[model samples]
Structures are given as C-alpha cells and as structure tokens.
Target: MSAFPLALPDDAELSARLSARIGQHWHRLLAALRPLYGEGAWEGELAARLLGAAIARPADLRALDQVREAAPDWFQKPEMVGYCTYIDRFGGTLAGTRARLDELSQLGVRYFHPLPLLKPREGDSDGGFAVADFRQVDPKLGSIDDLRALASDLRARGISLCLDIVCNHTADTHDWALAAKAGDAKYRDFYHVVEAADQVAAYEAHLGQVFPQTAPGNFTFVPEMQGHVWTTFYPFQWDLNYANPVVFIEMMDVLLYLANQGAEVFRLDSAPFLWKRAGSDCRGLPETHQVVRAWRAALAIVAPAVALKAEAIVGLAEVLPFLGEPEQPECHLAYNNTAMTALWAALATGDTRPLSTCLTQALAKPAGAGWLTYVRCHDDIIWGALKGVIPDETLARISDFYAGAVPGSFADGQAFQAEPGAVRSTNGMAASLAGVRDGADNAAALARLRLLYGVTFALDGIPAIYMGDERALTNDPDYAVEPDHDDGRWLHRPRMDWTRNGGPTHAAIARFAQLRQGRACLHAGNPARPLLTADPALLAFERADRGGDRLICLGWFKGDAMTTDLSGLLGSGDWIDLLDGTDVNAQSVAMAPWGLRWLVKKNG
Candidate 1:
C-alpha cells in the first residue's frame, strides 16, 4: 500500500501496484493542499506517511476491496436499501446489534449507518457528534472490539457498515485540545487561535451563528489558552486549523484507521466547514472542497473499498460541490437533505410544487455517485435549503402548521428555537409530523404514515429508514427528562421497540422493500422525472430504466378524499397498480384520505 512496507505482501504484483498508486495520487493530493499549506509545508511528507500507514491495512479488508472493485455499482442497485440509527437506541449495544442481523437482513437492508458512536465529552455531547477521542468508541455504546465484531457480523450478512467521522471540530476535551491547554505550542496550533477580540470580530462579520439560541457565535474564549478560538457549532467543540498541514494529516489517518476497523463507508461530517478564512462566509469554501478532494485521493491509494459520504446540509447549489466535478470526484455518496425537507413540505401543504422544483433543479449526481434519501433523519428539519424553491408565505404556513402553531394541525412538533424573528426550524418524529399520533384518527394516521413513507421508498435513490421510522414511531414526550434533554432533536431519536408496535409499520416497510427490490427501474441510478400531473394534492414521480421498466408513484397527502383526472399523465398503454392488483386507467382515480398508488408496467 506504500512505497516502503515493513514487509511486502507475498503477492508481488499487488504490492508493486499499491506502491505505484502512492506516487500516482501524491501529485493530485499535493496540488490540492499547496494552496492552504503552501509549497514549503510538509504536506507531501505527510501524504507519504499516510501511504505508509496503508501498508498496515488488514488483509481481510484488502480482500473486501477486490470484491467491491469488481462490482463498484453494488450500492446503486434497487436492493441497496439503507437504515440509520444510533448503536444504543437501535440495539442496546454492539453485541445486541449482532443478535439482530437476521432481522435486518429480512428487511432487505444492505447499508446500515449507525449514528456517531465515537467517544465524546462527558455530558451533552450533541448526540455523540462531539468527539473527544478519534479512535475510541463511547463506553456507553461498547468497546472498539465490540464495534469491530459487529462490523464483521454485518459484513458476513451482506451489509455495509457506515460510520460517522466528525471532520469539522473536536470536543474541547480531545487530546489535541487538552494539549493546547497544557501549554504545548505545536498542539495549540492545531486549533484556530485569535489573541485579540477584533480578530474574532473579523471572522464573525461574515459567519452566521450555527446554534443561535445556544452557542450564538463563531468564537469562544478559552481562558486556559488565553485566546479566543473559533467554534462554529458549540463552545465546547473547537474548530481545527486546517491551515496547518499536521491537522490534515492526523484527520486523514484517523479516517483510514476507522476504515481498517471494518467501516465500509465514512460519513464526513460538516464537510463544508473544514477550512475557514477571515471576511468570508466560512462555509463551502474552495479550500474545503480541495481538502475533501485530497482526502478522497488519499483514500483511493489506501482503502479503495471504502467510500466517503458527505454530510454537508447546505443549499442545493453549494452541496453539489462536495460531490466534486465529474473529472475529480470527492465523495461517493451524499445526503439529499434538500429532498428530505421538500418531501415534508409537500406532505404538509399537499402541494408538489416545492418538491418538484427541488427535483427539477439539482437531483442529478456524478456518474458513480448517488444520494442517501430519507424521509427523516436524526436532526431538525431546516428550511433554509429550499428558501427560493418554496414561496416565503407558503413556507410560513407550512412551517407554522408543522410546528403546531395552526389550529387543528395534527403535527405535534417542537421548534428547535422559538426566537421571535428568526427562521424557525422544526423537529419531531416523521410520523407525528405527518399527522400520525395519539387521540387522532388511528386509521388516518396510519394511512398518512404509509403514504409519506411510500413516497420515500418510491423515489429514485437509496431509500433510508430512520431506525424507528418504519415502526411509525412518534415523538418521544419523555425525552425532555433525559440527561442530554435540552436538544429538541432527541424527540425523534427514540429507542426502537423491537416489538415494532405489532408490526403495522413493519409490514408496510417489508412490503415496500419487496416491491422495490430486484427492479432495475427502482435503482438509484435510474432516471427519475417529476411528472406534472397538475394535481395539487398528489406528489407524483416517474422512475424508468433503460430496459423500459417504469414506475409511477403517487402519494395523496391532502387528508381528504380526492377524485382527480390522471389521464394527461398516461398514454394508451395499460398500467397496473403494484400496491393492490388493480388496473390503472386514464379516467379519474379515487384515493382515500392518505393513500399511495404505485402504477407500474402492465406485466411488472
């Protein structure tokens, strides 16, 4: 894997080829880095050192590399479904997770993304996103050994393990941060340190507050270091100074270290905020993209089997850069947060205009990349990404309704911050926000949940089930009493009920999996076009394969019975509903309060 291995592998060609890759990728890596680290810096030396570490990559993982290279598009198939959750919430611990492999396999989930399990600060660790240690697992979740064991079990069962690697900042308690406080000049340079108040003001002028209610600003004063440090999210999370080549080298090594531990995919958290400069937005900067590209190059030479997933939740225009240009790709997969929120807006307003606009604009990806699409994930659903797509007045109405500010609004959601004039982001369980909750009509709630989830699966991408989402799990009222109770996102990040609430949600999930799997038309790589049926209550999309297999998914979210003419959307060819064995005709169709129709090829 490197030019100099302690002991070369028995296979001569493999060793020579790997050694050659180090030189092949080094120039690109240095070219990307020289802008930040400069020509005199040890960026090249650090890059060579990283290549040296690759020589130690486990043999088993090397074997996995070959399996992946042979079928690189394995993740783009229809059968590649993803499920995301916390290790503790999903299954008590790593050992407990292994015990449920059979259940996950039965659900047809091939990609399993466990939320941050890395060691974090003592309390209020931002749900483990604040990492205190790069290599250790949170003791509450399990030991590193347990994680490796779980990963091994998952791999054997044909599932790929996707883990989070928080790349933006480290907890103040991280070794590097602690060393800085202990008067180490080298380690002190690891963080962005400003000695004067005006130095902080310069960066703040262009940066917006990430946590306006809690953290409030971009810099925090650390008395121990006698300087103000840049902290984009929280004061306890110290941003790294990527201008220093050592910081880049260390983080890159940590990424490779985790990949060797059996993680097939690494979710690079806060990808846009990696690099910062004064008098700039300090987000999605060119330097950040260069850093990501350099890391991707390093990964190519080290662990080609693994993939990097971008976790940047910015506007559609800004997000596309993280995927890199077609010639030089950065991430292999990225979250379609734009679509995730658009789906919610469409469901809340019963209008597809907002959702359709988003799809029409930036749904396309690089040739080898795909989006990780989900109805809900472990975060507050913010509307900033769709600011222009949805009208401001419509945005207010939808936000208010979902925030439970409107009368008769069934969504029991909580605002992340109830500030007077700020854009209010909402957080709640997907089912609860979709009008599925207690005391309401159980039948309607079930139907709405099914409809929303059905659209999620029907879309052209890797459909991800937020662990408890499939069970139609609602907001957790009792989450307010937990140790880290202040964060409203905890309401939706509830522990899973293995019972699955009598399998109502489970049945629908399995049904969708069964219908979507083994269908090339449903693959993430297939062409998905928004069909303008001119129906306000319905959100329609048509997915088609090169082989002519087609699927038309329509989800009725108006919560009222509707009979609409769908004749304009269809040709003379006969189409059949896949949900129920019924023929779909050109005439007006009747839909229940919250129903979904999956019209497919007559014989499909």
Candidate 2:
C-alpha cells in the first residue's frame, strides 16, 4: 500500500497564494505518509478529506490568517509572556476568566494557556487529559460559545489563547471508543487492540510504564471488545492508532474546528507517543514528525496565525527531532523540559553542572523556533529529560530528595509510582519545593522562588509562569487524600487565590516586564548562552541578540551568599544591573543568598 505522490485538491475558498502555499507543503505531507502507510487508496482519501477541511475553514479565521501572514513572527517576538492554568482553578468558569482580563493585562501576559479545558471522562479524567469530546468545553469551565467569546476578548487585548489538544489518545467513553466497543469495524481500527496475550507480551518487551502506580502496563484487557487495548497513560485513555488514515483526517478536522473558535496556539499534548511501532521505544518516531508537519501545513492552509507547541517532555536529543531543521519546520514552539527538570536537579544538589548543560542544549534551538520555558507545569517532574546531563546515581539522589526520602530534604514532594523497578515522577509546587510551605531554608523560600522566576524571565524563550508560582502558592497536601484524585500531580495544581497574589513575586515579574519592553535582546531569536562561573553554585547565562544588545543573567542556587569572578561572562563595558540598581566594578560582584542579578550593557 503506497501512499505517496497523492493529489491534494485545491480549495475554491482559498486565495491563489494560499492555494499555492498548500501546493508547496502538500508533497512534504505525502512524502511523510508514503513511508508510513504507502501510496495506496488511503493517501487519496485522506488528501480529499484534508482539502475539504481547508475549504470549510471559517471566514473569520481566514481573515486572521491574512493578518498574521503580514506579521509572520508575531509569536516569536520578544514581548511574548505566557501563563498556564486551569479554568476551574484560575477562574470559576470561562465567563469569570473573561472578567479577569484586567489582571492578565496588568501582568503583561500576552500568551494565555488555559490547561485542558476540553471535556474529559466523567471520573478521574487525568486532570482533563483523557478528552471525551474534543469540540466541547468542560461544563465546569464554560460552554463552547463562552470560550469563543473569551478568546475574542483576549485577542482584542493582544493576548493569544492557547488550548491543549490531546493527540495520542481519547477517553474510553469517547464516541469512537464506544463505537469500537460496540463492534464498529471502522472505530475499532482507530485504536490499537491486541487479541492475544502473546501479542501484548511481545509489545511489553519494548513498552515502558507511564503510570505504574495506577495503570501499571501499556495494555488493558477490555472484556466487551474481547481484546487487550493499548492504554499508554491510563486504562480509560485509549491510544489512537495513527497508522490509520481515517483517524488522521478526523483529528485534523477537530484541529481546524477548534481554530475557528479562536485558539491561536495548540499545545500538542503527549506528542511523543503519537506513532507506535513494534521492537522500538514507540516515541519520537519519524512518522510522528511527519504527522506534526502535515498538521502544520494544514493549519497554514486554513489559519496561519495559530502555532503548534510540542509537549515532548523527553531527553534533549529526542526533543531535537520535534523541532525540525529550520527549512522543514514542525512545531513553532516546544517545551524547554530539560531545563525545567534540570532546575530542580540543580536545586537539590546545589551543583550547576546539569542546569548549565541543559541551558547549553536549549541555546542551540533552530532559528525560527522557541521554547515554552517555565518553572514547573501541571504535570509531574520526571527525571528522564535530565538523563545525560546528570549522572544516574546523582539523579537518583535528587529524586530521593524531592520525593522526601532524603534526610533534611525540605521539599514536601510526593514521588509517583516509585516501584522497586519503575521510573518515578514527582509532584510538588515550586513554592513548597523552595521551602515556602514550612518556612525551611531559613525563611528565604520566597527569595529562592523569586530567583528561579528571575532566571526563567531572563532566558531567551517565552517565559511561562504557572498559576501558583507567581504568588508563592504552596502545595495542596489534601490532593493525596482527595477522592478519585490520587494522582500526585494535583499537588502543584492548586486553586488560584486571586485576591492574595501579586506580592514580591509579582513585583519581580513587573520589573522583568518593564525591562522586556522595547528591549529587542529579550527576543527568542537570541540564544541563551551558558556562562561558566568560578563558583559551582552559581548558574549564569548571557542572552544577546545580533543587534549587539546584551543582558547577563545570574542565579545563586546555594543557600549562602557567594562572590564570584564575573570577568569570564562579562564583557568590557559599564554594565548596569537591571534587577537592582547596584553598580558593580569591573571583575567582582557579590550576591545575596538565593539572589538573582540581571546586568545589561550600559548602552548598546
């Protein structure tokens, strides 16, 4: 079954230039699918369906496409700042979220990521990730129309709305899953189903557990279907079989449908697990990139303003493929997961080697691509992304420290599924890990938290601040006891205390916002170069653009004050500290415990 050299028909609604853009990328899509599915009947049918979607794209969205076509690098510009939160937590509902635009405007948040607002399974929805319906918004959040209204209002204020699109799986109660259970031949092919124990055992040899504490393995037996279904994350979440062309067309339609509702960025969740093959790790596969690029092409044909953000929380080497080489662009933005996990590792060990290594890796991103960097996100912190940067034994120690297994470890984090032979993930808020919950680290937790956020702000990528981190919101210890919510990730996902926030952290954020305005050095095009420091506890980096504007960022990971030689990273110039107005002489600068420094070249 060869699926290459397929004809993707032109859409009548598309302008000649837009149709030509489709013509340019359609072959790349065919080239990707041919090796995976072959140039057979499936290719022609999928091409027709994709063209139909392009034609059916809303007129309003096509207008947006034209506007953004004029400003191609809008999202990549320096002023982009993101905030990720859940609607039920950030606001009571979509209407409430709309009412809070003043707050987002006050914080200068141009990119808003409302985490997983889509409808999910009735019970234990994996924090809304096990999507039951792609087009509907969660009733607890708001209606679909409310989401559209909120998105419109956000766009008017120069903010881009981001939503999560789960690509790998759907809830067991999803229409397709239900149809498959009812013996619908077409729907059954949408998911991976193994008939025999032997088949499951064969795949088990190569499969790794995503949630060992609860889900255990990759396959779950469904008696009604009379076969074992592939459930990568949970038994309720069935992994979609991407090898099937029908599944591809249906999901591509869902993407365009949501774009018409005003989503400017789609966070491609679980992107690494999209394409599965036997005798392999079944992650970050070549087919996976093809599907992403194809989706990118489809969006370009319909709504060019929207961007895809890959959530491949894997090792740096594995993540490189997701951000395709500059010429063949895949995701416009991807998560800086290595630096996120390495930040915790560095804090646990007070050694900047792994953190510095992660920074060095991120500094080498493709020209047109940028990362979504944050202190921590809604999920657990897995140690896999930091594998090569830190030794295995040391990583285990850091894990133990965050998991509360090590003595004097002040972080009140819970380890998820640390079975004797299983890889563990961790859960805890940044504030709790920084000792804010119990006032550990001599009551300097707030300062320590500020230091981390400062580093995140000073970095070259789009800095995203999670809901709780800005206010020093501590962990919710009650999550472990909550019914149907034993997942450790809820520890970090606490409800927003909107009234009590905007303290020192917010003040620090305001200062970073002030410095970022009109300063082209903060743009994503500038790579964050890791700066070597004489002190092992200080992590520093230099972010400078081609235009010669430079900013040097320094973070003290240690609990005690330290003075270090700044000559290595600092150039010959009168540098002004942007964070604080302290004047430092040529070669030496002293930092307070858990302090942060931002030094800019006196004048460009």
158, model 1: CA deviation in Å? 1.1
RMSD to native, candidate 1? 2.3
What TM-scores do the predictions have? 0.95, 0.94
RMSD in Å for all candidates? 2.3, 2.6
Prediction 2 TM-score vs. true: 0.94
Write model 2 residue lDDT over 1-604, tens digit each, in one string.
Answer: 2332434446454647555766676677666667777767776676666666666666776778888989887777778888888888887899999998887777778999999989999988999999999999999888999999999999899899999999999999999999999999999999999999998999988877777767788999999789999998999999999999888878988898898889999999999999989998798888899889888877876678899999988888888788788667899999988888888887888888788888887766897888888898898888866766777787778888987899988677877665445347688888888777644442587887888788888887789988867778888878767667777788888888877756787788767766887778888888888888777788888888787888888888888886766775686767778888878654877889888888887755
The worst-scoring run of ten residues by lDDT in candidate 1 lies at 1-10
Q: Compose the digit string of candidate 1's lDDT tens values, residues 56-105.
A: 78888888887776887777888888899988888888888888777688
Model 1 spans > 4 angstroms off: 1-13, 40-44, 418-420, 500-502
Pairs in clash, predicted candidate 1: none
- Model 1 earns a TM-score of 0.95
**What's the lDDT for residue 567 in model 1?**
77
